[model samples]
Target: MANRLTPQQQEFYRENGYLVVEGVLSREEALAYRDEMHALAERLRAQRTVNATWPSIRAKNPNVHIDHCHDVQFHSAMVSRLIVDERFTGLAEGILGPNVQLHHTKMFIKPPAKGAPFPMHQDYPYFPHEKHTMMAAIFYFDDCPIEKGCFRVIPGSHKLGPLEHQSPADHYLPEDKYRLEDALPLPGKAGDVIFFNYLTIHGSGQNESSEARTTLLVQMRDPTDCPTVQTHESRGQGMMLAGIDPNARIRPVWEKE
Candidate 1:
C-alpha cells in the first residue's frame, strides 16, 4: 500500500490512457485469486442459464464465454480484500485524485482456443461520471501473451470524448469503426496490473493459446460521481475504497410493495 506510482508513471497514464505494472502481486496470490474466481464462476454458471435472471453471460463464439459477475467482491473474502487493498487503491488514487469509490468488480475467464473477441468499446457509456474520473484495474492471474488475447488499446483515447458506437448496446463498441489502426497489445505475466481510463477504446482478440486467461477487472471512480442514467440502482453505491468521501450523506428511499 505504501508503494505508489511514480510521478512519471502518473504522467504516462495521463498521456497514454493506460499503464501496465509488473509485480503488483505474486504468482501464488494471482493463482489463488484465479482459483477462487473460477470456483464461483462455475457454481453461478451452473445455477443459471443466462436466461432466467440478472446475471448475464456474453459469448465470444460457440466455445468461448465472457463470464461477468456484478457483485463479485461479496462472493469471496479473498477477492474482497484484493480490490480494496491499498496496492490497487493507491494506483487508482494516483490517476483518479485523492478519493476513489469502487463501482464494480468482475472476473474474465477466457478458455484456451475459444476465448472471444471484445469489440472496441469505451466504458464511460455504461455508468458515466460527470467528472470523468472512472477507471479500471485489470489484475492478471496467469501469464497472458498475445496468443492468449491480451488487452488492446488506443493510447490517449480517453481525451477524445465519446465516439460513435454500435451494439451490444452501451458497453461493447466496435473497434473496427474507430481509430484503432495503431492499437497496441498489453501482454502481462501473473500478478501484473494494467490501469486504464474509463473512456479508453479497448478490446481483446480471441485466445489461440493452450492456457486459459483468468483476470479480475476492478472499476473505480471518485465518490462525487453520480449515474447519468438509471442503468444501476444504488446496489453497491457509496462504498468508499480510498480516502474520504466529502459527500457521504444518508439518502432516503421509498418502500415498494
Candidate 2:
C-alpha cells in the first residue's frame, strides 16, 4: 500500500531495465487527458491555417504524424500539469533516487491502423550523455492491447549496450543475424505505467486495432548526468525553462543544485 515502488519492482527494473506498473491513474483521469491532448492537436492543426495553402502542406501534408512540440521543457510542464500529482515525482525519485531532474516528455498517439511500428533503437545512443543509464516512465491513457501497438522491450537487453537496428523496410531474417524480435506487448488496461531505463532497447508493433494507442513518456536522470542536444533548434528559442537554457551560462536541468 506504500505509494513507493516495492523491492521486487526495483529488482525487476535493475535487472531487466524496465518495470510495468498498472492502475496508477483512474479511467476518468486518463479519459480527461485524452480529451485534452486531442484538443491540443486540433489547436495546433488550426494554427497552420495561414500556411494551409502553402506548397509544403499541399505536397507533403502537414497533418501526417503529430510531432508534439519540440520543446522538451514546455512538454515537461504540460505533463506536470496533466498528471498534477506528487506521486509521479515520488515514484520517479524512488527508482532514480533523489536529486533528479526532468529530462524530456513526449506523447505518442498511434491512431488505429495508421500507426506504424517504431524502429528498434536505444535512446541513449542519440543522447549526448557519457552516463550509460537514465530512467523513463510511460503512462498508458488507454487500453494497450497487442493489436493496438503497445510498447515492447527486450528483457535484460540494457546491459548489452546499444544494438544496431535493421531497417523497417527489410524483414528481419534470422539467417541475417538480426536479433530484433517481437518484444512481449504488455497486455494492459487504462492507467498502467511502464518504467524503463534509457539504455533499454524498446519499440512498438503496428497498430492493427480500430482504437488509438495513446501514451505519455517522461524521462528523468540524476542531476550529475550530462545533458544532450535532443533537437536541431538553437538555444535562443525560449522553449526551455529559465534554468534550462542550453547556453553555457545557464545551469543544465540535471545540474540544478
lDDT of 1 by residue, 22-59 (tens): 98998998988888878988888898733211111143
lDDT of 2: 0.61
CA lDDT scores, all candidates in order = 0.76, 0.61
Clashing pairs in 2: none
Q: Which stretches of candidate 1 lie over 4 Å from their true place?
A: 49-60, 168-171, 179-182, 252-257
Clashes of 2: 0
User: What is the Cα-based lDDT of residue 180 in candidate 2?
Assistant: 31
Q: Candidate 2 at residue 165, lDDT?
A: 43
Worst window of 10 by summed lDDT in candidate 1:
51-60
lDDT by residue (tens digit), candidate 2, 185-247: 676877878988877777676667888777787666665566564442232222221123234
Per-candidate clash tally: 0, 0
